[model samples]
Target: MRTIMVKVKPNASEAKIISENGNELVVAVAAPAENNKNPLMRVFEL
Candidate 1:
């Protein structure tokens, strides 16, 4: 398994990987930051 740093932007207009710097990533998701939903999963589904 591999681990990386992810910065999440919830409630975005769309889901996407905004930027990646080495092991760090900035991800945006349309899902709100609530209800225990995994924003990363939403990004992957797109």
Candidate 2:
């Protein structure tokens, strides 16, 4: 799994993590409050 240090800050609504497709930041999914520590891991689908 991989992690992305989003420029957006945490605890700021899930909408903060936008997707960059075609250089355009689009709304992806609504992730719940993830109270995780450093070195996060992300599992992508497709």
Candidate 3:
């Protein structure tokens, strides 16, 4: 599925991905080996 929207909040200790209508997608953040959480997620979005 293609992503309609994405948001990253490293400072707030959270990362969220919502649909076109404010519905959040289910995803999990793992350890540091992912080369920073947001970047991994961002790439996954692509």
The number of clashing residue pairs in each candidate reads 0, 1, 0
Ranking by lDDT: 1, 2, 3
lDDT of 1 by residue, 1-46 (tens): 2234344456667767777766556565465668436545322211
lDDT of 1 at 26: 58
Worst 10 residues of 1 by lDDT: 37-46
**Which lDDT tens digits does candidate 2 get at residues 1-46?**
2333334233545545565554344333333346533333344433
* lDDT (Cα, 0-100) at 1 in candidate 1: 25
TM-score of each: 0.39, 0.26, 0.21
Best by TM-score: 1
The residue-by-residue lDDT of candidate 3 on 1-46, one tens digit each, is: 4443333433434444334433335444334434555443432343
Q: For model 2, give the 10-residue run with minimal summed lDDT.
A: 1-10
Say which prediction, candidate 1 or candidate 3, comes out ahead on lDDT.
1
Residue 44 Cα positional deviation in candidate 1, in Å, after optimal superposition? 14
Candidate 1 lDDT (Cα, whole model)? 0.52
Each model's C-alpha lDDT? 0.52, 0.42, 0.41
